[model samples]
Target: MMSSIKRLLIGRPLQSAELGEQKLNKTKALAILSSDALSSVAYGPEQILLVLITVGAAAFWYSIPIAAGVLILLTALILSYRQIIFAYPHGGGAYVVSKENLGVNSGLIAGGSLLVDYILTVAVSVSAGTDAITSAFPALHPYNVFIAIIFVVFLTILNLRGVTESASVLAYPVYLFVAALFLLIAVGLYKIATGQVPPVLHSPVGTPVAGISLFILLRAFASGSSALTGVEAISNAIPNFKHPAPNNAAKTLIAMGSLLAVLFSGIVYLAYYYSIIPNAEVTVVSQIAESVFGRNFMYFFIQGTTALILILAANTGYSAFPLLAVNLAKDKFIPRMFTIRGDRLGYSNGIIILGIASILLIIAFEGQTEHLIPLYAVGVFIPFTLSQTGMIVKWVREKPAGWIPKLMINATGAIISFIVTIMFFLTKFPQIWPVLIFLPIIIYMFHTIRKHYDAVGEQLRLTTCEPSFQIEGNVIIVPVAGMTHVVENSLKYAKSLSPNQILAVYVAFDREEEKRFKEKWKQWQPDVRLVTLHSHYRSIIQPLTKFVDTVEHKAREANYQVTVVIPQFIPKKGWHNILHNQSSLLIKTFLLYKRNVVITTVPYHLKK
Candidate 1:
């Protein structure tokens, strides 16, 4: 029964050969890395408009400038992270950067921030896709969470199968999205030039009037920066790329950055040019598509493209989150299980955890991208700020051959990222501070676990010390399994201890075996005492436990300390616990409660 459950959760173990080659080629690596950044074009404009809707239709035009600023920031961030990939080609990413320059605590902050951002990336992208589908069909709106969860489960399975397999599946959709977006932009611009464009969208919400505060404008730009969330995903995924890790990673980043810039710029321009305003009354993307291609199949095509892109964006998070987590686990920041690779050599535990967490967020936020937008950029910018700062420190400490040039770049990137991070905090503080509050609590919990692990490790470190103890009237009890290596080892250990008396114990459920063992004991050791306890019931723990109690009671009456030597066989495989539960553990735990008793384990290692 337990085997069935194990098979259901983790499936079969994968051999090393099944994992294929360690290196991923440039093309495949680019596909895997660019997925998140490219998918950003699908909903990036929509998120900006969702924020501007509070002010009104006229303010929606500002999305263009906002997107442009985000593009600049993203480009700078990509270049800064590119240096990171080259410097630490082993794929430490932000965590590595901060650790090497800033300190371990700084690295942890970057790690925690990235972890939260990846989780939110999955949630926001999947929920946004659900919204797009609901807009296309209108019927799925009520069950968005359920639909999103189903999608996450499907993607999780794909990820568990293999990274290359999942990447191949997503590559086409991402390419199609890039093509369709450019086509829409070109076609929409032609219509505007020909004076065939329709009237601008009218909204009851206020317009972008003169004298709007600088605070409001900064807020708008900060909200627009959600498009930049997935830019660093490539850096986190560098290790998964094929041979010449740095070169492939750098190329992938360039492709991702260039593609993201074109797609994001086009989407923002098209949305603004078409006057796509936030409508709580209607789905914004569909409404915008309808305006772009009136009464034609192009509308359905654009809508379909958008939905596919958003779903694929969620898939990007599915790949990245696990790899980042695996890196964290290797650094001892998270549980070791997360570091265990799946049958396909991917971080299966991390992927499943990410999928489940995303599903919960979808449910909690009710699959509304607008509702989650406040919590979104906070995590993204936290890592951005830390990573850029770390890079600046790196520039200072290591004065390379091109030190002046790199320092200038790092300084510029740091200033830009730092300002954006500040803007995000200022704009998102009221509605988003709760998320910030919760993150530190999680970091603290992880820190506590790390501290505990460190303490236990310190305690377990072996030192040169003799196994000597003052014997206080000892009567040693050795448990024998009739004849086994473990029994022989137990007798040897028992004889080493300074005991005035010694007795060999054998408990048997069958009388014939008990009688045979008693007769054999006399032949084996003529002088050594042997005793057998019998029970009609075939229960190993209960019979042995009762016998130990009887012997302890007699030893207490005789005012002698009892030293029990138990022979334990250690399995070679880690999964051997599935074959045998904690029977020996239970007996040892029960015996530890007794006063004036010492329980020693004589372990026999099984050969692999």
Candidate 2:
């Protein structure tokens, strides 16, 4: 049944022999790993401007310092994760890091944070993109949620189709976004230098730099930190690259860092130069484009590009969430279903789950980027701090003398990330506390589920002791339906249990068949006692319970223990339930409820 669904979703499965290793060259690997980082540039500037708008334009200049801090942190994080990729490149990711160093609960916390962050990445990025498009084409504003859903569905289908397919589709759009944004920056700068002095948008308050506070500056920093959210994707995906994993991962990391830094800095400078501000009314990017290009085709072009980039940011989640789920499945933290590959060899369940979650988020928040921004950065930073700290622990524990300088670098990175995480939690808690409240509930659920699985596993564990059935003269009642293979096999197995006696019992809804079976049993198996119970209501369970009670009473009178054995046929195909039956299970349940009766099942397997 599972195989049928897998085939339906992604066509034929690749045979074990046909499956080849992931052969990612440096360029392709960089594109795949850097997608999340590169996509962040789309919203990083807008987020910074979003916070500044709350306190008026005076706070806008503080974006420069915030951007600078983020850049430094980004560099430190990249360098630190580079060590992670080299040291533990087999792809446990942040969860593995925390587990090996900090412990399982720490890993669970990190995993929870990463899971929430990945979902937000998709929702926030897609919504931001939709806003950009709506800014460019005002008609789209009313249909923003609809547009975001369509984009998410499209991304989900592409991901379900396979990773290479998704990469091929996303690579061009991401590259186009980078190129267009760079061109806009270069031309806008040229306009400024040539005394063209592209008109800055009129500030709602008349002049810039009015009514700002330190609290506001911190708020803007928290919002702007959304750009750094995707930088950890490389660490998660290192194992997917070509051989010599460390070298490939390092190169990918360097490329991602460089691209993010350039794109992020350029966007920040442009947003600041244009005096973009927060409004209960208009979008910052749209107003800025209108000011720079002055109500012309150039204005439309900039708005359109910004919108596309925002929508494409969801592609980052399309790529990362499934990988995170797959990692979790490997650790037994999530359901094993996520560990299974689809026909295309991608984690289809994870992709679909991610898509649905993002869609729900889009609806719940009404596709508003500002609302989702607060809940976004906290999770990513928490995992970032924990993973980096875990890496520091790893470095100290291993203590390779030659790598002391690298260890110090990683230690510094961990400290910086930890501080940032605390700052984000303290300042953004009003907006973020809800997530903190909700995440533990989810973590606890996973923990409970894991405990249940472990308990069941212990119960089912095989032992070397010889099989022993202590019958204490228990009356063994074997339910027989007719001359089926299951019934015959069950009787033979029951005889092996060496019970004191066996009663062949039959409960029949059809009087004619019951009469015929009674006559036949009298002639054929006279040595065996036969008990036939009558059913007035034509209910199988009631009739069976009546017969088992009589048997238990007889066993008590005879000073024998009552034991019931039912023949059950286990189906090979999971979906044969509609055709085959489940009467044996009903009988076993009824028999077990009677006093002094022990019910056992002797399963007979159908031919494959």
Candidate 3:
């Protein structure tokens, strides 16, 4: 019944052969992969203005220059990643490039940073989307965290269906957001040209307690760089694209970068021209929309689309995080379970994990974009620096076609990214410090995982050794509760394993039950010898475990193997399990670590 429900909700399980059908074409891929970059326009400029507002209204003018800097960085990053697409077509993005070129430690750092960045992507995107909702309908403000978590869960279900499925579900909303923003830009520009612009209002401000400085502008730039967080996602998930994956991904990157630049620059320009100030009750974009559309239908349309796109942007992390985890698992840097694909061929483990992490962040920060905004860009720029620096090293070593120019571009990107990372960390210390502290710990975990895998491989490696078996045959022990069909089946199976050395042992806690069981056994004339032992303390596991230990010790002394076959009853209904004592579980747990003792459970399924 549960499987039917899951199949109904997520669709029927697809075979691996259908993976090709699941590959995304360009349009849908852009919608799913680029939503993060595109949706940042909803909050990126607002973040810049938020930092600028600290000094006074005069500092607001600095936003334009800061935005231009971000655009420049965005363009450089796009170009660098375009080269990365052609270079690492297999897709590990920075981690792959850094590991091959820079070193293992460099690769681990990039992987750790990207992992944290993906989690923060879901958190920040969902929080910002929730803020968009609350801005439109203030009465729902208190439930924003809950709303954000619901969105995460919804996206997880969509993604678990398959990448193409999620992309198709998300395409219309992303396109609507694009059209809404462009319409706002076009209409706002028309109003500005026709001298129909709404009157600019300056909310009363507090006296400047701290003067604005160069450090303030740098911090604002760092804050605005949130726009670039998901740009590398395309490079990381190139395999998800249709045939000519590299070319398609490159085209999508250029398209996404172009859209982001236009939308972000236009929004920043409109915000500055309209003298929009950051208000706690409403968003900068919402304020700009109201000034242009005067709280009409178009205003609400823009708000609705903003929220939809922002919520859907979490899909970018859903698409990329699992792919990243697959790569890590392939390298033995993490658990192998992450490498297993779901019924729909999606990385189910990674998707569920990303959802849980985002849910925690939303709850912890109460779904406030302002708080999550500060923690956003730090994880992003670390990988930016490492990946670009690794690319520079690649160029220096391989010196492929046009390596010099590529080398120069990546070097510049590396330098700029390194500075931005430092600034980002300093601007949001302690809160952002969790990621920094956990990075080294994650790297150590990777090493430990590798070490353990190595140790296991060494232990399991086979070497030729002469076999010694003075006591030629194996001993099979069947532990029975009574003369029931479960025991009969187990005894028959044990006889098949070793007909000459089979023993059925019963530990008796009640004398009357034992006498009745013996009487029935004698009447039935079972083919095997039955050993009955009385336990005065009434401990089933202790007596059974000690008996098995004694048998195994004798078998080992004679250089022979011992097998313990146990029968277990499986209830037809799950709830019926509680009515039984679970003696089989207790006995199995006790014998799990015993040497040379092979334990197997033969289940007797009960019919309702």
lDDT of each model, Cα atoms only? 0.75, 0.75, 0.88
Question: What would the per-residue lDDT of candidate 1 be over residues 358-425, giving only the tens digit for each residue?
Answer: 88888888787776766776777777777878888887787778877777766777777777678877
Report how far residue 389 has shifted in candidate 1, in Å. 0.8
In model 1, state the lDDT of residue 124. 79
Task: State how far residue 438 of model 2 sits from its true place (Å).
Answer: 2.9
Candidate 2 residue lDDT tens string, 1-608: 77687567565655545334434566766665576677677667777887676776656667778898888888888888888887788765787799889998888888888888878888888888887776666776899899999988877877776766667666666677677667777876787678776545424222456567667666666677778877888777765666777788788888889888988887787677677665534566566567667779877776666666666666666666777788877766788788776767777788889989989989999998877776887788878888888877887788786677777777777776776667677777777787768788878977887887777777677763445444446566787888678877887877777533777888877789899999998786676678887777877788777777776776677676777888888888877766766888777766665666777899999987
Runs in model 2 lying further than 4 Å from the true structure: 1-9, 21-23, 198-211, 279-282, 293-309, 402-404, 463-608
Candidate 3 deviant stretches above 4 angstroms: 198-210, 463-471, 509-538
Name the candidate, 2 or 3, with the larger lDDT value. Answer: 3
User: Residue 47 lDDT in model 2?
Assistant: 77
Q: What is the descending TM-score order?
A: 3, 2, 1
Assess candidate 2 and give its TM-score to the true structure.
0.78
**Cα lDDT of model 3 by residue, 1-608, tens digit:** 88899998789999999999989899999999999999999888988988888887766767878998999899889999999999999888988988988899999999988887888899989888888989999999988888998999998888999998898889999999999999999999998888786544332233233588878888899888887889999999998999999999999999999999999999988888788888887988999999999999999999999999988999999999999999999998898889998999998999989999989988888887777766677787888998999999889988888799899889888988888888877887866877767888999999999888877777676763535356667888888887788987888888788888887888999899788878887777466777777899998888888888898888888877888898998999888999999999888998989877889899999898
Q: List the residue pairs that clash in candidate 1.
A: 24-242
Worst 10 residues of 2 by lDDT: 198-207
- Model 1 clash count equals 1
Q: How accurate is candidate 2 locally (lDDT)?
A: 0.75
Q: What is the TM-score of each candidate against the true structure?
A: 0.78, 0.78, 0.94
Which candidate, 1 or 2, has the higher TM-score?
A: 2
